[model samples]
Target: MLPSIIIVNYKSSRLILDCLHSIYRQGQEEFEVIVVDNSDDEEGRKAISGSYPVVKWIRMEYNAGFARANNAGIRAATGDIILLLNPDTLVEDNAIAECAARLRSSEYVAAGVQLLNTDRSPQITGNYFMTGGLNHLMALPAVGRLIRWLGYRLKVKKTNVASAEGLVEVDWINGAFLMVKRTAIDKAGLLDEDFFLYAEEIEWCSRLRRIGKLCVYGDLHTLHLQGESANDAFGSSGKGYYNLSDRKGYQIMLSGLVRIRKQFGAGWFIFHLAAYLFTVPVYLLVTIIRTLFLQPGRKREWANWWGFSVNVLRICGFVPVILSKKPHFYKVL
Candidate 1:
């Protein structure tokens, strides 16, 4: 039997239905698909329940956020392999088959796939490690472009028709189209519920990587539309990260890094914190002006900056707490 593909949806009613139809277009029955809807209401629930009968659907009365929503589906999954896919992506024929086949063949690999933009442009292929030290970078538009440039020069994204040949280890594959083994997902535990939106994949894959290897099959590809980017539980105005989401993502990553550093004694946590502070002015300006990403108005973006700054202050408040009181900060095992 094939793995059960889990798609977490919110406000993606039509897209979810269409995505399910496309998956069937692959003409493969080895896999099952489970869709978890975190729509604020049951409109999507009611509409899809009677309409789509091919798969299992879970309608959540309250929004459970992104990672938690997927965790819900993961727990219900029965496939030896578990595919965490986005609802907006259009899977080309054989995409799912190839990803599953490649991952199954590799003991070290947790997941792998080729992700493309809506326009068929190659998005990052293969996995990557999310760095926490001074050199670790968040792939914002600027950083994304830089990484792509480096990838193109290195010819590392995708090389040939060999689906699994090019990459061996990655920080993390884009959650947009990740295929993992059931054993790996179970070993890694489930997706961390702490991440309501961004960086959850990085955190999840980071743990899986500790166990074995993670990569992407760049030679094959799936089409991800620009409009349907994130399958988030909560909503994004796109102006920037909301106050609550920003606070959660930042603290989640910081908390992870602190735990890791205390064990390794990396001292890079201080360097990373310094980087975040320096980035404060830059990201603050980015948030305030809404320079590049077309989202909300400038005023809305500034509010996001103000929100992030508030969280940073709160995080500083806890540094002494973790150091003096909790003392369990470094214990990863």
Candidate 2:
């Protein structure tokens, strides 16, 4: 086989079906499809598996989060090349083939495809590793906007994928459409299961970097219905739910803490604590101003404020009873 594509479906049966449809439309049979149903949706699984008999469906006992679920698929996959694709994605013709080709041709351990939103707008498909300085700047509202504006103007921005050509090296590619060589997996080891959802790929990329380079292929693109599962879980509580998904926000923060603690150690955790403390007042002020002014996206601003507050508490060793009792937010039903 050319490669084994693994997709973890979390209660997004309809989306996964659409994804599989796209794959079949591509008419590439040199690979296999493995679907890990973390949601354990029996009806959805049966329907999809019956319709797409070739798809390998693994019914999970419960939600195991992104990392472990992917690891399960990775273990079951027999291909020398492993692809971790999101269920909420539509693959373009030859996109996976091109990525697999790039991985085989180059010394790179992993390769990812350009991903776009439904409107065909380019998404942030890849990113540089988060540094303390960059994280601090992004945490401050004023500086963050300025930094983003500068990045947009610089033309070297990560999201400027529409004009990007060929395969470019990157610190890490988003897990939505990541492809990795089997040798790289053997060398770098499986993804850290500590990260339930968000930041898992970033941590895994760090390990891959130790073994080989990671690149983002710009020749092909995939349509990604971003956050479909997360939105279904924690959305529509109020106005402009599209601006922010609380489920994703919480999982990102929790997984981010896990990533920082593991990757950078206690020193960086203290650094993050100091940085969060320094920016809390500014974030609070921004939240109040945005709310009182009835900003167009006040909901998202408030969501960011809430996320920062929760993360600060976590940093201070004060875990809420609910979260303390349940460590992985992504697995919560």
Q: What digit string (tens of lDDT, one per residue) describes model 1 on residues 1-333?
A: 667898877788778778777777666767778888876546776666676666788767666666778888988888888888887877876778777877787775466566666666666545433234322433222333454577678665342222344554565677778777888776778876644555567667778877787766666677766334341422332322223335344544455445434423445555555555555577665664563576555575666566656655665655654444344322110
- Which of the numbered candidates is closest to the native, going by highest lDDT? 2
Candidate 2 contains a number of clashing pairs equal to: 0
Give all TM-scores, in the order shown. 0.70, 0.83
- Residue pairs with backbone overlap in model 1: 126-216, 127-170, 128-170, 128-171, 128-172, 129-170, 129-171, 239-296
Per-residue lDDT for 162-264 in model 2, tens only?
A: 3346777887888899999999999899998756777788889889989988888877899888877666765524321122224554455556656666666
Off by over 4 Å in 1: 130-168, 226-270, 281-333
Each model's lDDT comes to: 0.62, 0.73
Q: By TM-score, how accurate is candidate 2?
A: 0.83
lDDT of model number 1:
0.62
lDDT of 1 at 240: 25
